[model samples]
Target: MISLPEASLLALFLETLFYGVFFTCYWLTLGILLKKYGIQRDLLLPVATLLLCIATAHLIIDFVRALEAFVLNVDTIGADAYYSNLASPLGLAKTALYVTQPTVADSVLVWRCYVLNNRSLLVGIPGCIVLLANGAIGYYIVWCLSRTVAGTSIYTTIPGLITTFYILTMLISIVCTTHDDQDMTALISWRIWRSRRSISGGSADLLPVMIVIVEGGAIYATSVLALLLAFLTGSNGEYPAMDIGPPVVGIVFCLIILQVHFCVGNNPQPHSPSKSFTNLFGEQGEQNVGYGIEQMIEETDRSV
Candidate 1:
């Protein structure tokens, strides 16, 4: 008969299977986006590639950990040695995979915030600091986890950092949605909420992408919030959540990029107007009065 530890290991294997499916979907969608966008080379490619590598590394680490638990521990070493082995360096390395996954995922969100804000240093500084602090705290926790086995104190503190990261990410998304929407000239300007209604007529082409971005961020942020709650409550039931959270993070990021690619391909909206034309048009196109009204009209009709 399987014991509790064995059962938990089996459940973790199942969760790993689910994560594999999500990872596969990420690659497929990434390929489709690259093809659809006609992106020969872009920054996002490297970011996606890096994430893929990290996720693959995580999977490898998980597999090794499972082997240690099931084969080495259960089949050969006996329960006493098995439990002892769990506190070994390899065991802590396995646990470290979880930390690495979320950190990289959060960094990706931070990167998105930077890009969305027109690469403004001022805009991303806070997020960068928070991200670094998260990494530092996580590293400390991992070091402590490796060295000791008696206490829940370090583990409990992790949720706070995770919560802060998620809250900051949500704030970044909200700020970009509300303020940076105006900064993006390629797409029609519309706030995240009430987007479909606000962007009427031909301008509505960009609405779907906007919705995807907002919803994708919300999905990730909500998952983080749930994970934080699970950790804070100090329940063993948090296992399932802990197992699946990383994959959910990957899914949301991939979904956002895929949806944006699909919408942009279908929409084929115009590029941002040239700087001189923008200055002439202003917000109301009434600032300059009569200078480039005809050109602005031409650009608007052709683009929007």
Candidate 2:
């Protein structure tokens, strides 16, 4: 029942809030990556920076659009009219940024999965195909939106494309979440199971589950799922959900890196099981963890 202007204002407010959280996490993540791997040794720093830039741009665009709607053009075009004009440059730019941010995030995720599976062609092929499809559909949605007449509801104009785009978004997130959970679980569980004879604590048994929980992509996946549902149900909730997507992507990306860095750094005993576990992520095994994580740990140990 919310009007388009109300939804736009609400979305800007929520996006600003999420952007604050993302900025904090992003800086902390940058610090850790710099201390552990520096710029030359790791690609994650650049990737993270790219994500931050995109998210910041999205936030700024939202702010500008909100200002134009509620303040600058209040007497002229009016708030509702400003927001309802989807073909405006700012509107189109916002949509393009939204599409780009998630595509980059999902690409990084798929790359991580490929690395985790030791660069297997099977994993790489399927992931690339899905990623291409995702990008194509996402941009196509943007293109469709751009061509629609002003003040028309997007859901009404191209309902099928909107639905397809969100479904693909959800599908990508779900696939990444599933692969991350399964791979992390298998690696940690196998290690703990092997070392069970030497170790005596139930706490160690929980490490696999804990690591899987921390590293899993469930948070991003859940958000996308919620967005898809909101869109499908034709609710105003989709506006805020769409607005939150960029920051959510950044937050999830940074959290995974930060978690891995601290988890490795906290247990630095020379012969600790955690060290052995970290080692398993290197080239010696068929199953690998993310390159950034492995490199961060190695560099941290060298500095110590």
In terms of lDDT, the best-performing candidate is 2
lDDT of each: 0.47, 0.66
Q: Over the stretch 1-304, how does candidate 2's per-residue lDDT look in tens digits? A: 9877888888889889989988998898777666643322265677778888998999999999888887899999998788778788888888888889878877766665565454568876887798788788878878877887876886686788778877887677665542211223333334434443244343334443345444555677778788888888888778898998988888877766555544531322233344343432322221222333353344434544
Put down candidate 1 lDDT per residue, 240-291, tens digits, no spaces.
Answer: 5555655655665555444433343233213432432222212222211111
Candidate 2, which segments miss by more than 4 Å at Cα?
38-41, 178-211, 264-304
Candidate 2, residue 29: Cα displacement in angstroms equals 0.7
Residue pairs whose backbone atoms clash in candidate 2: none
Q: What is the lDDT of residue 17 in candidate 2?
A: 91
* lDDT of predicted model 2: 0.66
Name the best candidate (by TM-score): 2
**What TM-score, computed on C-alpha atoms, does each candidate reach?**
0.64, 0.80
